[model samples]
Target: MTLPLIHTPYAQVRQALLDHTEIALLDVREEDPFAQAHPLFAANLPLGRIELDAWQRIPRLDTVVVVYDNGEGLAERAVRKLQSLGYQRVSLLAGGLQGWRDAGGELFRDVNVPSKAFGELVEAQRHTPSLPAEEVLALQQQQADVVVLDARRFDEYQTMSIPGAISVPGAELVLRARTLAPDPRTRIIVNCAGRTRSIIGTQSLVNAGLPNPVSALRNGTIGWTLAGQALDHGADRRAGEVTPAQRAQAAQDARAVAQRAGVRHASLADLERFAAERGRTTYRFDVRSPEEFAAGHLPGFRSAPGGQLVQETDVSAPVRGARIVLVDDDGARAHMTASWLTQMGWEVWVLDGVDRSAFTDTGPAPATLPRPSRPVDWIAPATLAEQLANEAPGQTAVINLTTSANHVKRHIPGAWFVLRTDLERALSTIPSAKRYVLTCGSSLLAQYAVEEVAQATGARVLVLEGGNQAWADAGLPTAEGEQRLASPRTDRYRRPYEGTDNPREAMQGYLDWEFGLVAQLARDGTHGFQVL
Candidate 1:
């Protein structure tokens, strides 16, 4: 049965944020449109991905959820879907996106606005020091006493980095900086793909009271590129393990910083108490590296690398005012990460006294959801290839439900890229076929949509076993490009700093946007950010 629709006005939403009450302001539009404009706290959930992500993101069924769209007619459908999925308090944003504008709510552009805005605010309040890319390059040429640390993910550092820079990631900066540069006189330069991580990472070291002189590489790699500097590709330099004395000092400094930022510490018993709370939402994360997390981690703790968690808070914890519990075996990383989260208005806690014995779970966190009780019909990749070869042009329609970006990169040749939510409309556009084979990156999402497709078309539908990966593994012929797209490629937002081919103006524009975020935060007034 469909639940009654609830309308939550912009004023009420703003009040909720100001009160530090739990509320998930979700923009149920594709990422491209979502990145264009949204409220300060709005997280992009995307209407089509509700089933796949809703359970994991909004874990508590009773948590209040307000979904909106900019006249895309998606919010109403999203409410119904959430209700079906057992979410009890789903509502529509009263008046939608335009309503927020009508009520004078500040709308922010780009993804991860809360964290990015907080970074700018930190820089403004603390006047975080930085050096231009050209100056850093000149210092390198002169063989100055400087060590460059890239604060982005290892993969991002590998993609493009300052020549000879080491990948220390943001959370590792404070814990590993002293080990990387033993000399107190050594100048440390921090960078990322863009601005936020650089600013935050630099500020973290300064806040932690590191002896080395530190500064952010202004505008990060973007600044380097705009200054006509070439970046190193496939760089593999990384921070090494810290010595016992270094780890002890780093832990002491990190704990001091976290305490000043009003971060709390919780014992395992305290964590259990938090978990048992009936109405509140609590997110438990192991704030360690992926490899460390895979080796062993406490059960029920999802792995969220500390730096990425701080950089992508919206993606990790969409519920704005929820409680966050971070776990790490090394005392420094969790404490340092908690300091940032506390400053960003989270009621965050670092788990204390965790030993090796607490790590019971091993390997990566399982991505599987509860499978359907009814067995799903599936076709092997080779068999599907044979059927396609023997079948007529319109005998079978292969629908790919993977992300638009992945589909464009590689997929079974002739497969139509279609959004699962729009399957009914998509079926009408494709030529009538006797059978439909559905596939996604792993066929997980595709499995959920089989019944819907069958109901809509009354045709035989089967899932592609192991989806696109299995097809590729068999050395079957594949195709690339946007050759057969039934849906628009708006699932992923193209970052200005991602590739080498972005226009100079866009890169400069992105930097300009970052510069203005401090003022935007002032206008918003709901963000409870404090910089130490």
Candidate 2:
């Protein structure tokens, strides 16, 4: 006597999902079908990925997967793929998803896990609180008790944050929180556009055993906007800085802590002696985020993301076996990075830059930029503009090299970012067109971007001079922020191409390159192109 065929009726499947919180109910239907209707607990895995990218979507093969589709042939294929992949607890909802609805089961709409929901979850268990728009306004008016920590990049923070928020990215929280909130009585509040980082940031302090209570700005800037609060950038409101006395104390405290943590504190003489050793393979790491790294970092130091550097130091520096010197404008980053590296068994040193300029001891031959009066061998913006004027429509590719925030904030008519940190992932996703213009905050970065592209694949490369700042400052028109996720291509990690230097020419090189890219496009065929 055989039992019923072990069939999972729609009701049973629904019950199974509700019974196990860990179970993942996957909607295998195409977007249209899922948009129309899907199980309340289902996460969309799109039918196509169930075969190829399933492993990435679901890391644990044993995760209970109840797959379904809208009466299409896709679900069966998805199930077969899961079975082949050794996903042990895989099952099918006896009938396609429609059957669940037919049986009076509930359906969910627009239920993608949004950043806001995640933000709330992060705030809830993490003791993260957000000042509502009214509260924030009142705080501003009352000269409040809370300190807003803008957990975005320094540049993003510079561009915008709550009126009094300070720029404190996630990675820096563990290191800088102490200085910012010295009293522990100071209420610490973290914020990010959507969530993730803000939530993680607030939790870091709580996890660090810091006695201070921490909270995240509920919903970040978006939430602030939703609540009709005012936002500002450093342009109008600058980030808080440690005063001279505070800076001195911070430096002293940092040196003592660093020494105790096993990080070698090197004097200028010590650094010189180390540099004198010929043949010794030593790599310098500027452990700040790329934005800060670009703003100004130690001479000859390469940018290595702090988190990745901590996790995979050997990969980032194969000379990992070599002596490593870490530099940072403030002792916080240098010490934090050094502490982590010391634990990894590397010979690490922290250069004391509190009193000395990190760039002061450049060997006799200092790093230099091209002279503005230097002969213009590269295709100048004028030349590119002239040629572009002659070229037929659709014959050019537009590669914008501006920062994502800036690109979103404003950009040349059709420019795109050519060197995003996630270039490989973004390549397939970016639009393929005829011409490409490497862009950035300034033209030098654009040129640096062009060099990167040249090394990878040969395509038309045009560098914008002076970059976006010049264009905007010149009173030129610009786009106002990309409202959605941009092609990953534009999000490349740019270790080079900073804005401190001036082009031999171009009064407004930065802004012209980014905002006036369309004007540059008018010139297409000028010769003598060298990307330096």
Best by TM-score: 1
Model 1 per-residue lDDT tens digits across residues 1-532: 6678999999899999999999999999889899999999999998777778888888899999999999878899899988888889999999999999999999999999999999998888899999999999999999999999999999999999999999998898888999999999999999998899999999999999998899999999999999999999999999998999999999999999999999999999998899889888999999889998999999889999899999999999999899999998879999999999999999999999878898989998775364543469999999999999997788889999999989999989999999875677877888778899999998988988888788888889999999999999999999999978988788888999887789999999999999999999999999998877
After superposition, the stretches of candidate 2 with alpha carbons farther than 4 Å from their true spots are 1-144, 158-164, 168-184, 192-236, 239-245, 252-262, 267-282, 286-298, 302-324, 328-333, 340-347, 352-378, 387-532
How close to the true structure is residue 280 of candidate 1, measured as C-alpha lDDT? 89
lDDT of 1 at 125: 88
Q: How high is each candidate's TM-score?
A: 0.98, 0.42
Cα RMSD to the true fold for all candidates? 1.3, 18.3
Query: Any idea what lDDT model 1 has?
Result: 0.91
**Cα lDDT listed for each candidate:** 0.91, 0.54
For model 2, state the Cα shift of residue 517 in Å: 41
The C-alpha local distance difference test score for the whole of candidate 2 amounts to 0.54
- Candidate 1, residue 418: Cα displacement in angstroms equals 1.4
What's the C-alpha lDDT at position 431 in model 2?
Answer: 56
